[model samples]
Target: MAAYGYFLSCEEFSPSQLLEQARMAEQAGFEALAISDHFHPWNDEQGQSAFVWSMIGALSQVTSLPVTTLVTCPTVRLHPAINAQAAATSAVLTDGRFRFGIGTGEALNEHILGDAWPEASQRMDMLEEAVQVIRELLTGEQVTHHGPHYTVQNARIYTLPEQPVPIYVSGFGPQAAALAGRIGDGFVTMTPDADLIGRFRSAGGGGKPVIGGLKVCWDTDRDRAVKTVHRLWPNEQLPGELAQVLPTPRHFEQAAELVTEEMVRKATTCGDDPDEHITAVRAYTDAGFDEVYVNQIGADQRQFFDFYRTRVLPDLPRSR
Candidate 1:
């Protein structure tokens, strides 16, 4: 059976709301959580971007469900060594129920430091080196290295869990997936693309956990739910690599203007039909994702959880 998780949208909720949601999620029977990490929301309409590390620290205190950064970018903004320290401390705080999920990152968050965004290829290279640095530091051993994309000098993570934290790498394409296979303890992506998961396994990631997530609005008024997601998450419909390269929330707003209501309807599952929610989430399990996270796109989180606990989770099958 695939474990179902609640996805905390840091871009759309305040820290307090997130904590409460975490408690409600566990009460609803979700076994884990995946939270977005961003310096800014996709647009001004979404209106919140609490620091993920701080939210995680708060989550550790009140929730028992395991938490993971849906995908933090350790390649830029924060050095990998610093991220390793934060992650180690988070695992300690969470009683070793934390998993580290990381990606190359977006220009919107990383560019705030005045660094030029590297091409996707170079970012992949940087992610590899950064993961290596983090793995070394998580061992609680001092590490020194100078690689193509990063450098470390006797950096070590002092606050560590009993076991080294599992690092999951995120990738949307084959090249990155293969890298995730070779270096990551696990793999993460957003879609139900079995081929990508197969590629990861063929390249050496067999038997490791695969985490995937999708967005859904669980309101009874279907049209209003669509409007809510359209207003707050038009960025979801952007094609190609726009979500990764857009430099600011305003740029995202401008680009997202081109996203139509119809596209949002086609991309997200909106409404209260438990059957539709079951079908929507089942795709991830069918695609071989070991865990699936559902992000409630609007503020009606408690309603969504109540619905899932009663109507949705029963219909979904678990693979683990």
Candidate 2:
């Protein structure tokens, strides 16, 4: 069955705003909540980046819906042992409703720690090792490891859930997708690419859930919304390694100069009507996602939720 959910821009909102959004999302019948875990926003203009672990703690108390980090990098910013403890505590606090979603991550976030960012193959290798370390720590037993990528000594998670939390891995390419299939309990990705999911399952992810997300702007003025998205999120259009090599927001701003507002509008749904949002989400469903999460851009949070609840949600193809 396909589940519908909301993806909160955790790096773009204050902790208080996120708490309120979580409450409202639950009230609006969202089945799950996904939060972005970034060390920094792509651009300084976005204005917020709270530590996601703390935000998840607050979210657990404020809503009944299940929560997952849309994607977090286990390889950088935090050590796998520490990540395991954080996930364990979050699972307990949320009563086992938290899923730990991990990935190799972007340079924009990981580079802040001053660690040398590795090549894609090396990052994937490190990700696999990190996952193993995290899983061991989550077992609530003392763990020690000296892997090629990370070293751990006598680490244990004291506040684990009765059951281990599911791990969802995000994969952008074929190799990473196969790894996700082999190691992850579930799969997470941004684009509506069923071929990638098929690759995942074929690689051994049988019966595992696949989650996808998309960005949209709901507003009365379509053109204005598109312009706003381009202005604020222009980095989305940049392809490949530029996103990784760029060191600062100013670098992103310079690259963004090449992206047009038309590109943003064509890539995302932007309009007042609920059907537009439905159409955009349907693309993911049709592409074979088990869960399709939508992220509504802009500040009119109430209007966005109300429109989805009243008009968009009913039009979606229900899960069998």
Scored by lDDT, the top model is 1
Q: Where in model 2 is the C-alpha error above 4 Å?
A: none
TM-scores, one per candidate: 0.98, 0.97
CA-lDDT, candidates in order: 0.93, 0.87
Tens digits of per-residue lDDT, candidate 1, 1-320, equal 79999999999999999999999999998889999999999899999999999999999988999999999999999999999999999999999999999999999999998999999999998998998898889889889989887889877777789999999999999998999999998999999999999999898899999998999998999999999999999998888899889999999999988988889888899999999999999999899999999999988988999999999987777544
What are the clashing pairs of model 2? none
Model 2 Cα lDDT, one tens digit per residue, 1-320 = 58898888975688898888888888887889999998888887677888999999999899988899989998888998889989999999999999999998888889997889888899999999999999998888999899898999877778889999899999988999999999999999888888998999999999899997988888889988898788678888998878666777778888888999888978878988776787789888888898888887778788888888888887887674
How many clashing pairs in candidate 2?
A: 0
